[model samples]
Target chain A: MQMDERKRKILRAIVQDYIATAEPVGSRTIARKFDLGVSPATIRNEMADLEELGFIEQPYTSAGRIPSDAGYRYFVDCLMGAQTLSDEDKEIIERESTKKICEIQEVVSQTSRLLSELTSLTSLVLGPQKGKSAFGKMHFLPYQPGQVIMVIVKENGVVENHIVDVGDNLTAEDLQKVADVFNQKMKGYSLSQVKRSMLHEIYSELSRQRHLIDNALEMLDAILDGSEEDEPIYLGGTLNMLNQPEFRDLDKVKSLFKVFEENEPLKKLLLPRQEGLNVTIGGENTLKEFRDCSVISATYKVNGKTIGAVGVLGPTRMDYGKVIAIVDFMTKSLTEVLARGKPRGYK
Target chain B: MQMDERKRKILRAIVQDYIATAEPVGSRTIARKFDLGVSPATIRNEMADLEELGFIEQPYTSAGRIPSDAGYRYFVDCLMGAQTLSDEDKEIIERESTKKICEIQEVVSQTSRLLSELTSLTSLVLGPQKGKSAFGKMHFLPYQPGQVIMVIVKENGVVENHIVDVGDNLTAEDLQKVADVFNQKMKGYSLSQVKRSMLHEIYSELSRQRHLIDNALEMLDAILDGSEEDEPIYLGGTLNMLNQPEFRDLDKVKSLFKVFEENEPLKKLLLPRQEGLNVTIGGENTLKEFRDCSVISATYKVNGKTIGAVGVLGPTRMDYGKVIAIVDFMTKSLTEVLARGKPRGYK
Candidate 1:
């Protein structure tokens, strides 16, 4: 629990060596690899103290030591800094974030791919769920002689259509008159605002004007009553787990993928923090199955309001310093892109 | 290639054994597991002949014979039949196919998940691109003071919205008048039908009435001009690749994932035939990366028109009989769901 300067240096050495070569770091190897200016015996004594203190462990396969979950936590929480990405990486993140994307879904999907490709680790992005959007347009178009289709668009570019039955006698011009009223009232308002106004005004009016295309008004009311569903969660490089030595066992891979199948409960892992990146080392995650993994996540924003999260999932031996910087840079870049919403030529 | 009954039986026995155990089948083991009415020495002689004919192989690790790509092709082409799914599996497939889902994307995504979970292999579903949907409705809604959003809905429940600048002097009533014209003429028609009528009529009218709200007309023209982009390719159970005994090599996993990335080119592997299921074993695939793997695909339809394909990807040692049956049943089930489009109460 109480770490001196010499102990910290030796622990860092063990962690770095183990990460580089998926093998245990012995005292001689650490002493030789790191210019700590100490003999293998002295390093071995410090390693013994560190292992006794629960920072590292000696694997049964070799005399070398590897970082335990506690060791990784100390490294991530106490020693890690804001990693500086290379200029090439920065350029890649910036370029990918600013590239021409077709739909908002495409943006989320492309970002997931880029994050995984950059890190060679599994990446996940959640949110911009199209639930709270500014109300855009509403219209009633005739379907069959007795059926009319109501179409609504949210400012976030989500569109929904509902089929409702209207009287055969109700003409298109008559339906247009009712649509005009909805437009007059809903301009520049979000779906919530429209809901509030409709509850306040449309009910009594529909009751009184039952014959004057009121059925179409009721249909418009119903269409405006709801927003779109949750935006898709994009996951990339799921098979990257196989490349890790930790996942060579088939059972471990199954449990990890079982967590992926249950995406709903995993969303609880994303907390509502306002700023800064969050790191949860092995054994610190909410799900028990993720004890062998590490997650570095950050809440991303659009127009300065945090709306979603982007995170990386990898073995505890993940390149924390590098991956954190990449995720951090991407969070900012994605925020900027999402804040702009749609680009000029995007469909 | 012509095959006698004995050779066909021997190939089938090898394929079934290899698929089950993921190990080479020695003549002794095959004789013990199956009553082939032959002694171990006779079975061994047949296996040698089969290996010489390229139907089976001897891995460096074992003296047993494993099915080659040709063996699998022969089994599927001549010996295999539709494997009967168990009652539990039938219940699962039925339950998953009939479950309530909100978005059409969810349908594709859930189906992918179900297929993968059931087969313990990677699953892919290509498209219902929304290009050939029955036209639903069109609506234009005001956004800012100077812009309006045009929304279109397809009967298949795909929604698209595009924003265009409108004259500041244009009233909501004027936009409604334009919508009414669309409702009158475009009802009960697909996008192709609208294109035909618009080409015959709207061009002359727009030329004659340029000043009478031509901007709104132009926006409608543009909205109707484009068809939907390719629907996203849904893939699931990628991590399942790691569970395969054949995928123990990381390099093999990487090459398989590389094929997953180049999805556009993979579309060429799908055939143009309108009915039934297809199997491409090992080198039968278009991409060289998939030469060690096999694909079992089936063309699915919405309203009797084949619009897309669904397939499973696994090693050549995959269970062709079981996977083919599942793919076939899923294709028909997916067709039913897509034709129904949306269930009651789905947003």
Candidate 2:
């Protein structure tokens, strides 16, 4: 059931037209608009063959034809051309991506939002890989009677905070000494490097401080080693999903809503272990619920190292030509800004 | 268009049965299952009348009846009985809710996951309301040369960190003195309470200790007063939406996914600032895309004060009977655990 060149052209034309108008496409419409130098009869014959091959379907006896799931699959893989972004679109993405690079979280969050706004589709951006960050410094400050605040700063400038118990009584000088020791020894080391041996070394050194902050030191070790829960997942422009007609069915709406509710599947779907712009079409996503949808994703980098993934989700009928171009340009723009590694100076 | 008591009972029976089975309800089947003490013919006549009034529909001439949108509306508003949770369900919720209350973010995230698992439906939870938590303390710790980490602890035991710049050269002693003054003056006061007059009072006093750190106080004030953004919205079980029959249509699926992407709309949807459980059925929600859906939500509290909202989303065919009971009970359980403040001293 292989399609000939003319049949491929007809299939692409139908899918393209259906995506634009969201209406069933007819042979007469394609014959008149596309100027393929074929008569209505010949075009109709090709459409009949296309339908026989499962690429198109007629809603009823009198209605026009629409692309079946198989039709969209072929269009995305073989027929669709790479859409070129307008100069204005490029400038918009460049401005937005470069606007905030100092804060990695901000860069990812803003990039998702900007991509969603530019494409008018749902966008997702994963945060920087925590495992990759080298420890730059850590500071412990006492707050109240029993609570202590711990801030971990990575070499890439990402800062995270955790609160741990410091028992009932501790002097300000004791906390300061603990902070100084941590900064001197742990700086420039990754979290993985701060293993049990490193903890034993720090514990023996703290014994010389008369047990003043021994509890705080143990708590610091726990905070650094145990805080390996998954990094935050950034989602943006969910409202954009509402604009697509695929969500009109009540059941389809609910199932898709469910996918957006739990983010673990999405995080796993966009895992940065993979390379290039990965497109998971219907039945390809790991999650059974997203079987009918498609995910278009790519990894973003900073200084030539992959940091996280940025992706967009829509129905299998997703306009791949446009979304792919936007995602491709956005990944490049994001890499350029993040590589600079400087906060946008305030006006 | 008005129905007698018997017709009402029959409509309720049909809707409830149809909702559970997702099958057309036949008169004979209803007669046998419900023991309505009426003949199948009598039930058939009433069902015919009901269909004329748009309470039910027949997919084909020979098929049994299914509840129409009007029938579902009626069941939700007037006929549906209050749902009671089993002891096992209550215990599971209580056990999960009481695990760790100090981590407010973790509580919200886990609660959303638990609710989704319990209901087998999508769940959404908003973060703690900023205005609800009074600021208790602020501390500063220096990291590297230009970076200073600011720790703000709320009265509810939530800790937040922000990294700010304090020029290029400041020692540990200077930062400690600056922190001491800030804690002494601003302890037990909210961020809003730190006004210009109060900032000036702290600055003039700090000038007496270290002029180098005093010069950095203005930037610190700006960072403290202006850096807070809206809290993040917690959503879970979005992938579950794909499991429902309602979202099978791509347009509806896209619309619902779009809602999860935009923070502002989601914040507005979840934060109506209303009291008690808020149930917005189809067409009642402010967002047009949600007109075909229903949201069952309730506000959770701490120490008898309203803090945030947790909700579940589904199609108009959503099990209002079950979700309403679950949301109400979970909110109560969450509030009780949070009010206790600390974990049980089992250790």
* lDDT leader: 2
True contacts kept of each: 0.45, 0.75
Per-prediction DockQ: 0.34, 0.36
Q: Taking the tens digit of each residue's C-alpha lDDT, what string does model 1 give over A184-211?
A: 6676575445575574565454444355
What interface Cα RMSD is found for model 2? 5.0
Which CAPRI category fits model 1?
Answer: acceptable
> Weakest 10 consecutive residues, lDDT, candidate 1 chain B?
B204-213
Give each model's whole-structure lDDT: 0.73, 0.74
TM-score of candidate 1 versus the correct structure, residues matched by position:
0.77
Kindly list the per-residue Cα lDDT of model 2 for residues A1-347, writing each as its tens digit.
77899999999999988888888888899998897999989989999999999888898996899888778878888898767887888889877765644556677778888888877777888866665556667677665567667676666566666665665655667677767777787787765687778767767777654354455445444445453456667777776666677666655555565566577888877774468788777776777767767778998776576767899887767788888888999998877776675542110
